[model samples]
Target: MNAVPFRRIGFDIARDVLGKPDILLLDVRDPASFERGHIARAENASPINLGRFLTETPKEKPVLIYCYHGNSSQAYAKAFSESGFGEVYSLDGGYEGWATANARAAAAAPRLSETLKAFLIAQGFPPDDVNAVGKNQMTPLMQAAHLGPAALVAELLAAGARVDAMNSDGSQPLWLACVGDDPEIVALVIKAGADLEHKNVNGSTALMYAASASKAKALMALLEAGADLTYENDGFSALDMAGSRECLDLLRAAQRRLKAAS
Candidate 1:
C-alpha cells in the first residue's frame, strides 16, 4: 500500500485547533514529558504501541500526531495512512519545537491597554493573566463584560478566552453584557456562543433580565438567536418580566420567529 505524505503544522495551527471541542491530538512522546505539560486536549500514545494505537484510532477524523522529536513518529504517519486512516500529520520539529516557538510568542507578546491591564493587576493577576481562569473560576472574557468596552472583550478573545465561560454564579459573558445593556456587546457574545438559555444564580436568563430592564434591543438580539421567551426560570418567563408593552412586543416577535423556524 502506498503511504500518503504527512503535513506538519506549526504552533499557530495547533493553538487554533485547541478551541475545537472535537479535535483529537495524540502526543507520542514518553509519559514523563507529557506530565510536565502537554498541548491542550492532547492524549499520549508513544511509538512503542504504534500498531495498537493505529488499529484502534478512529479513521474518520483527522489526527495530529507528535513526539518529543519528529524522527520516531514520522514513519507512523505513513503507517497510519497505509492502514486506512484518512488524515494524519506529524509536528515538524515535535513538542520541543512547539515549546521553543511558544516561548518566543510569550516573550514578544505586546502590552495590553493601560486601564484594563491596571484592572487585572489590581485584581492581583500576574502578567500572563489576560485569559487565565482565576480561582473564582472567572475568565477575562466574563470580567471584561462586567467592566465594558468592545476593546477589553476583543482583547481577551484574541488572547484565547472562552466566550461562553460561566462564573461561580453561573453567569456567562452574555449575562454580563445584557446587564450592561450594550446591544453590540450582546451581539458579539452571541456570535461567540453565549448560552441564550443559561440561568444565573438567581435562576434568571439574560432574556429575563433584559425584559426586566426593558432593553428591547438586547432582548431582540437574544430572541433572534432562538432564545426561549416562554422559558421560565423561577416563576416567570421573559414575557412576564417585561414591565412595558415594548418588552412584551419583543417577546411576541421572538415567539413568532421561533415558531417560524420550527
Candidate 2:
C-alpha cells in the first residue's frame, strides 16, 4: 500500500529538521547500537515504542528515520509515509552521518588553525578549498584524514569535503586514513561513506592497506564496518599481509563468520 516514496535526506537537511520543533526523530538501530550513541532527542524504534509511535504521534509532525548506514531506515520511512504521515524522511548515511555531523558542529573553529593553514598553503593548496585538488591529486579532506587531530578532518567534512573523492590511483580518503594509521580518521570517513569495496587501479582496498601497514586500529575499524575478509589483491588477501597475530586472528574469525553465513 505504498503511496509516494519517502524522501531520503542528507545530514544537512536533517539538521534543519532538528531545528524545528515537534519533529519525530527516530533511530531504528538495534537497542545496543542506539544505546552507544544516537542523535540528541532521537527515539529508538523498539517494538513497543514503534507501535506506540505509529498510532500515537500526530501525522502532522515531520518524521525522520535512520538506521545503521541509512539503508534500513528507508523501509521504515516508507511505511510511515504510506500510513499517511506527512513529511516523512529517511536519513542518508544513517548514524554515521549523524555522528560526523555532530562532530563537525562541535569542531567549528574560525578557520583552519594557523599552522595547518600555513602548511596547506606551503604544500600549494588553498586552505579554503576543502575539495581543491592538491599534492598527489588529493583533496584537503584526504590530506587531513591522513594527518588528523580529528577536528581538522571534521572541519573539512563540515565544509562539504567528499569522503568518496579519489586521487589518480583511485585511492579514496579511507585508504590514506589507514596509511596514516589513524583509527579515528578511518572511522570518520567510513561514517562519511568511504567505500569498503572500492578497488583502486592497483586492485588494492583500504582493508588491504591497513593490514599491510600494520595499522591495528584501522584494520579493526574496517572489520567492524563489515569489510570483505576475503578480498584479494592479486591473490594476496588481507590475511596474507596481516602484520600481527592479533590481526591474523581477527581476519580469520571474520572470514570464518562470512563462510558460516554463506
Candidate 3:
C-alpha cells in the first residue's frame, strides 16, 4: 500500500510549525524538494521509511506529518495513528498549500552573506543599538529571543546586552523563551549566556515554567545548563510547583548536584 500524505489538520507543513512551537514537523517530501527550501527546524522522513519514523517518534510529543501533495501521506497518517501514534496530525493541503503561501512567482535572487551582514550593520545593530533600544526599559533582545532569524538576539548580545537582562516584570529573555516553549531559541539564548537563575515577577524560574507546561525537553535542557534548584519563586522552589513526577525528579537531581557542589 502507498503512504498517506495528508492527515487532518487544515494547512500545509510549514504553516503548521509556524503557528505553534510545540509541534514537531515531519516533512515526507523527496530529498531534492526538501533541499531546495523547507521550513526551519523541520526534519526529513521519506514515506518509504514510515515504520522507522513512527518508531523513533516520541509518544508524549505531538507529531504533525506532511508530504508534497497531501494525498499519499494522508493514508499513512491514519495507519500510523491507529497503530498507536496518538495526537498525529497531517498537513491538509500538503506542499501545494505551502507553495501557495510561501513560494514567489518568479525566481528571486538570493542575498549574498556579505550583503546581509552589511544590511544588518546599516540597521545599527548587534550591541550598538540593541542595548540603546533597551535603555528605555523595553527589552528588544527579549522580543527577538521569542522568534527565529535570531539576528536581533545576536546583535543585542554583541552590543553587550545583558543575557540576564530582565523585563519590567523581571522576566529575562531566557525565561520568556521557556514560557513560549521554544527549546531551540531557549538554547541559543542560554548559549549566549542567559542566566538560568534570573526570576520573573512571581519569582518563577525558567525550570519552574518548563515543569508547569510539561515540557520535558525544555526542563531537561534547563537543568543541564545549571538552573538553580534551591532557588525559590516567591516562596516555592521548582519542585514545590512541579506538576508531575518527572518534574519532581528533575528537581531532586538538581538538589543532588547542589549538595555535591557544596
Clashing pairs in 1: none
The TM-score that candidate 3 achieves is 0.43
Q: Answer with 2 or 3, whichever has the higher TM-score.
A: 2
Name the lDDT of candidate 1: 0.72
Regions of model 1 farther than 4 Å from truth: 1-115, 122-124, 133-137, 259-262
- List the RMSD of every prediction in angstroms: 8.0, 15.2, 14.1
Encode model 2's per-residue lDDT on 88-124: one tens digit a residue.
9999999987777656754663456676676568657
Each prediction's TM-score versus the true structure? 0.53, 0.54, 0.43
In model 2, which runs have C-alpha deviations exceeding 4 angstroms? 1-116, 260-262
lDDT of 3 by residue, 1-262 (tens): 3433324776434342333424556778888888886654568877577777678767655677777777756766776676666567777777767666543421232322453345345544432234322332335566666643455456556544456655556677787667655666777789987777766667677888888777666787788888877776667777787788887787787888789889
Error of 3 at 130 (Å): 1.6
